[model samples]
Target: MLTQIQASFAVNALTVSMAGITTDLDTPATSVGTAITAGTFAMAAFILLGAKVGSRFGTRGVFQIAVAIHGLAMLGVALSVSPAMLFIAQASSGAVIALIAPALTVFIATNYHGAQQARAIGFLAAAIPAAGVLALILAGWFATTIGWRWSFVLMVALAGVNLVLSFLVKKVPAQPGLSIDWTGAIIAAVAVILLSFGFSGLATWGIWLATPQAPFDVLGISPAPLLVILGLVVGQVFFSWLRRRGREGKPRIFDLRVLATGSERAVTACMATMLFVGTAANFLIPLYIQVVQGRSSIETSFSIIPYTLSIFLASTFVAYLYGRFTPRLLATTGFIVVAAALTLLAFTVRGEWSQGFVVAGLILLGLGQGSIVALVFNTLLSAAPKQLAGDVGAWRGLVHNLSGSVGIAVASAFAVGMLSSMLLAGAQEHPEISDELIAQVNFNEANFLTNEQLAAVLESRASGPELDAAIAVNAEARLRALQISLLGLGAISLLAIVPATRMPGRREGDLPEKLEPDDDDVIDPVDEKETVA
Candidate 1:
C-alpha cells in the first residue's frame, strides 16, 4: 500500500505541477510531458529486470532498498531546476518502483487467504486514486503557496514512512541461482524507448515529410512513423525470443504461463486500452486548465476534485458488485460508460475552468475508469494461480506504465499537431495578423502557449491588433484540438467494448475465483530461504 501510494504521489504531484514546472524551467508543456514519459517508460523497461533481481536477492530486501532509493530520487525532484534534471529524477524513481512492484503481490499472496486476498487486491487498486485525492489537495496548495517544488519535498518525507513500514511485510524465499535474462531486457528496453520517443516526436517531426525539429529522417520521410514500425517489429522479436528461450529451457525474462490463455491476453489488452484513454484524459485536462485557461494550481485542483473523488469511491466499492455481475458484463458496461463520458466531455467543454455539464462528464469518467482499473486486477489476480501472483503484479505494472506513457506522449503530439495546423490556417485567414508576423514565429516547434506566453514569444514582432488576432486564433485552435482529441479517444474506448466481452466470464452472482496460497509460496516471518529451480 505504501509503495503504490508513493508511485501515485509522484504522478499526482508532477501532474498538477506541469504548468508551474514549464514556466520555471522555461520549456514547453511537451517537455513536462516528456519528463512524465521518461518515468513511465523506465517502469516498463526495468520491471522484468527488477523481478529477476528480486529473485536473486530477496523480495523484502529489494523492497526496503527500493523504498530508500525512491526517497533519494524524490529529493532529486525537489531540487531539480531544469527539464533534464527532472527527467533523470523521475526516471530513477520509476526504475526503483519496478523493484518494489513485484513484492506487493508477493506479500499479499504469501500472507493472505481467499476473501482477505480479494479485499487486499481492492485496497491495492484503490490506493492510486486515494493518493490522487491527497496529492492533488496538498500539491495544489503547495503550488499556489510556496512552490511546486515543495510537493515533491512531501514525497521525500512519505518515502521514509514507507521504508519503515516495509519491514513489517513478510519475507519470501529467493531463487538465488536464477540467472538474469539480459538479452530479453535489452530487447524490451529498445522497444519501449523507440515507441515512446517516436510517439513524442510525431508533433515535432512532420507527420509526413521531415521537419527541421526531427533529429534525422529516413530517406525524405519523417522518422517518426518509421521508428514506430521498428518498435512494433522489435516488440514481436522480443516475444519470439521469449518463445525460443522457453523451448531451449533457458531462463526467460517473463513466464509465458501468466498470459497463456486467450482470456488473460484479452484482459491485458482491455487494461492497456482503458489506461491509454484514462491517462490521455488526465494529461489533457490539467494542460487545458493550467496552460490554456491560465488557472492557478489550487483552482485546477478544485476543478478536478469531482473526478478524483468519484474514482476513489468507485475503486473502493466496485468489488461488492462482483458478486452480482460477471466480469465480462462489468467490463463491457464500464467501457461503454467511459465512451459516453468522453463524448460528453468533448461536446460540453468550452472556454471555461468549470461548468455544470463539464463536472458531470468528469464524474462519469471517474466512475468508469476507476471501476475498470479495479476490476481488471481483481479478475486477473483471482483467476491466475497463487504461485504466479508476483508475476501478475509485474505484468500489471508493465501495462500500466507503458500504456500510460504512450497515452501522454500521443495526446501531446496530437494536440500540438492540431495547434500548428489550426494556428497557421487561422493566421492566414485573419485580416490583422500579417504574413511577416507568421514568418517570425516558429510554428514548426508546435509549442502551444497562452495569450501571455504568446506575447512574450512574439515580443515586438507583433503589434497589439496582430497579437490579439494571434491569441484569438490560438485560443480557438487549442479548444478545438482538445475537443477533437477527446472524441477520438471516446471512439477508441467504444472499440474496447468488443474485447471486454472476451474477458473472464462468471455466472451471475458468482464471486471471483480465489485459490488458497500454495504451501511453498510462503516462508517464515522470521527467516527462511529457498533455492528452487
Candidate 2:
C-alpha cells in the first residue's frame, strides 16, 4: 500500500501544481500538459520491458531500486527552473514507475489468494484515490503558501517511506529462462511514443490543417493526425511481431495469453474507457480552477476534495460487493451515473466559479468513478490465471498509462482548439478593437490568461475602449470554450455505455473457464477462499 500510494502521489501531486509551474516557467498550460503526457508516454513505452525485467531479476529488488530512483526524480522536479527541466525530470520519474508497476502486482499475487487477494487488491486500488486526496491537500497548501516546488518535497518524503517499507516484503525467486524480446519491445515503444506525441501536439500542430509549429505537412494537411494513424498501424505490427515470436517458441515480453479470453478483453476495454474519463477529469478540473478561475493550487485542491474522497471511499467499499453484483451491471450503472454528472456539469459551469453546481456534479462523478475503478481491476485479476499475474500487470500499466496519456492529450487539444476558435470569433464580433491590437496579441496562439494578466497586457498595449473590448471578448471566449469542452466530456461518458454492455453477463464470482493448462493453476470458483497456485 505504501509503494502504491507513493507512486500515485508522485503523479497526481504534479497535477495540482501545474498552474504554478507554468506561471513560474513562463510557459503555457498546454506545455505542462505535454510534460504530464510525456511522463505517461514513457511509462507506456517501457512498462512491458519492466515487467519482463522483474521476472528475470527479482520483483522486490527491482521495485526498491525503482522507488529510490523515483525519489531522486522528485527531488529533481522540486528544483526545476525551466519547463524542459521539469519535463525531463517527470520522464525519469515515469520510467522508474514503469519498473515498479508490474512488480507490485506480482507481489500481491504471490503473497495472497482468493478472499485475501480480493481485499489486498482493493487496498492497492484504493490507495490511488486515497493518496490523491492527501497529495492534493498537501500540494495545494504548499503551492499556495510556500512554493509549488515544495510540493515535490512531499513526493520525495513518500518515496522514502515506501523505500523503507520495501524491506519488509518477502523476496520472490527470479523466474528462469525469461529473455527480453528486444525487437518487439523496441517496436512497441516506438508505437506508443508516436501515438502519445502525435495526440499531444494535435492543437499546437493543428488537428487536420497544418500549423506553423508542425514539423511537416502531409499533402498540406497536418502531420499530427497522420502520425496518430501511423502509430496505430505500427501498433498492429508490434502485436504481429509478438505473435510470430510466440509461434517460434521464443520467450515473449509477456504472455499474451492473459488477454486471450473474451471477458479479459472486455475488462481491458472497460478499464481504458473508465480511465479516459477519470484521467480527463483530473486534468480538466484542476485546469478549470487554476487557469480559468485564476485561483491558487490550494483552491483547486479544496474544490476537488469532495470528488477525491468519494472515489477513495467507493473504491474501498466496492471490492466486497464482487459476490453480490455482476461486473457488467456495476460497470454499466457506473457509466450512466458518470454520464449524468457530466451532463449536469456541462450546463452548470458559468463565467464565474459556481462552486455549488460544480461540486454537486463532481460528487456524482466520484461515486461512479470510484466504484468502477476498483471493480474493473478486481474483475480483471479474478478472470486471469495466477501465473499470468505479471502479464496482467504489464497490460494494466499499458492500458492505464496509455489511456491516461491520450485522455490528457485529447482534452488539452480540444480545449485549446475551441479557445482559439472562440477567441477569434469573439474578436470578430467586437470590431471596435483595432486590427493592430489583434495582430499584437495574436489571438490564435494566445495563452490563456486570468483577468489580472489580461489587464496587465492591456495596460502595456492599449488604453480605454480597446482594452475593455479585449477583456470582454477574452472572458466570453474562455467561458464558452469551457462549456463546450464539458459537453464533449459528457458525450464521451455516454459512449462508454456501449463497451460496458459488452462485458460478460456472468456473476462476478463465477469463473468462465480454466485460465491455464495445468489444473493446479486453475482457481476454484466454488470455494472462493482457496489459493489457486
Candidate 3:
C-alpha cells in the first residue's frame, strides 16, 4: 500500500507540474489549453477503462499494467518535441494514473481492518503533497537551471522506480462472471471528450458573462455557447441510455445505484469539493508569485514550501484524528479554514507584506484541504462493498480528476479574464502610453522580462513624465488582476462548504467502539488468503 501510494503521489505531482512547465516552455494561453483539455480527456478515459480492467484482471494486474504504461508515458514526455506529442504523453500518463489510483485505495480497504484502513488511506493522502513538495522543489530548480525538459526526464526516473515496485505487488483474484461493457465505455468516452472539449473552448473563447461583447457564435454563429449546449445534451442522452440499459439488466459502464448510498454520495461530494479548491489554489498561486510578487520560479517554489509542508503535516495528523473525531467536524473545519484563508488573503493583496499573508493563507488552505482529502478517501473505502471495491475506487478517482480539471479550467479562465480587464482598463487610463509598449508587457513572463523591454517602454514615454507614475500604474494593474483572481477562488471555495458538511463524521479512534468485533472476527480472511497465495 505504501509503495503504491508513493508511486501514485509521484505521478500526481508530475501531472500537476505540467502546468508550470507549460508556462516555462510556452505561452500561458497555450499551456492552459493543452493542460486542461488533454488532461481532462485522459483522466476521464482512464477512470472508465480502469474500472473495467480491474474487475476483469484484478487490482494487482491493473497496478502492474498501469506502472508499465506510466513509465513509457514519462519517457515519451521527456523526449516530446511538440505540444501535440506532450499532450499525448500526458494523456497516457493520465490513463495509467486512473488505473492505479482506485486499485491502490481498494487494496488498502481489502487488506486492512477498519481503523487501520483509515490510517492507511490517510497516509496515502499525505503522500500527495509530500510528493508534490519534492516535485515542485525539483521542477523549479531544474527548470530554472537545466531547462523544463530535464524535469520530464526526472519523472522518467520516478516512473522507473514505480515499475520496479510493481513486481512486489501481490496478485488479486478477479471477481467471477464480470465482463466489460464496451458500449457503455464508448458512450462514456464520447460524452467525456465532448464535455471537456466544450469547456476548453469556453475557457479559450471566454464565457458569455466574461466576454459579453463577444456574442454567441458557432463558426460565426456563437460556437462557444452552442458547443456547451451540445455537450450537455450528449451527456444527458448518454446517461439516460445507460439508465435504460441498467433497467434492462444489461451491462453499464457506471452503476448509478451504487451512488445512492449516503456515505458514497457524501464522500464523492467531499472529494470533488476538496479537489476543486485545492487545484484552483495550485493553479493560481504560482502565477501570483511570479507576476505580482516578481519572484523567480525557484523563489516561488520555495515560497510554497510552507504550504506543502502544512498539507503533509495535516494529512499525517488526519490518520490519528479519523477514529477519534467524526469526518463531518474535520471536513467542515477544513472548509472553514480554507475559506478564511482566502478571505484573509483578499485583504493583503496590495500590501508590501502580502507575501507573508499569502504564505499564511496557503498554509491554512493546505491544512484544511489535506484533512478533507484523507477523510474522503477513508470514508469512501469504508462505505463501499468489498466486492465492488475496485469499481467504487474508480468512481471516486473519476470525481477527483474531473474536479481537478474543472478547477484548473475555471481558475485559468477567471485569471485570464481578470488580467485582460485590468490591462485594458490600465491602457485606457494611460492613453499617453504606446500600444506597442502595452503589448510588450508579457504577463506570463513578468518575472523574466528583459531590462531592455522596460527601458524601451520608458524611453517612449512623454518627456519629463514621472517614471514612478508609470511603474505604479503597471504594478497596480497587475496586483488588481491577482486580487480579482483570488476573489474568484474564494467564491469557489465557499461552494465547497455545504458539500463538506454532508461528509460522515466517523473517526478512526471511534471505529473500534462503533464496529464491535467478535473473537472470530479478529482474524481477517484476506490476510490468511494472502499468506497462502
Give the lDDT of residue 291 in candidate 3: 62
Better of 2 and 3 by TM-score: 2
Model 1 TM-score relative to the real fold: 0.84
lDDT of 2 at 418: 87
* Native-referenced Cα lDDT, model 1: 0.81
> Estimated TM-score per prediction?
0.84, 0.84, 0.79
* Model 1: per-residue Cα lDDT over 324-367, one tens digit each: 88899999999999999999999998767558888899999999
Candidate 2 Cα lDDT to native: 0.79
Q: lDDT order of candidates, best first?
A: 1, 2, 3
- Across residues 1-533, which tens digit of lDDT does each residue of candidate 3 receive? 44444344444444445555566556454553554356557767668667767877777877877777776776776676667777787777776777787777667655677567677777777877787777676665665567656766666676677667766655678866676778777767776666666555566555653343343554444355565677678778877876676556666676554454455576688788778878888877776776666666566767788888898888778877765577777777777788888777766764343467766887888888788787777776665445556666777777776677677777777666666666557765775655665665554323212223444566655234444445656667666766777776777667766766776555433222122232223223432232233
Q: Model 2, clash count?
A: 0
Per lDDT, the best of the predicted structures is: 1
lDDT tens digits, residue span 1-533, model 2: 87888778777777777878888999998777777777788888999888888888888988889999999998988988888998999989888888988888888887776667777777887888888887877777787799988778877888888888887787878876667888888888999888877877786787888889998998889888988998999999988887777666676676666766566677788899889878887777777777777887567677788888888788877777767767888898998898888888877876456668778898899989888888778777677666567667888888887787678778877888788898887877787888887777665576567777889978978778888888888887777777787788878878877877766665433222346333223222422221232
Q: State which candidate, 1 or 2, has the greater lDDT.
A: 1
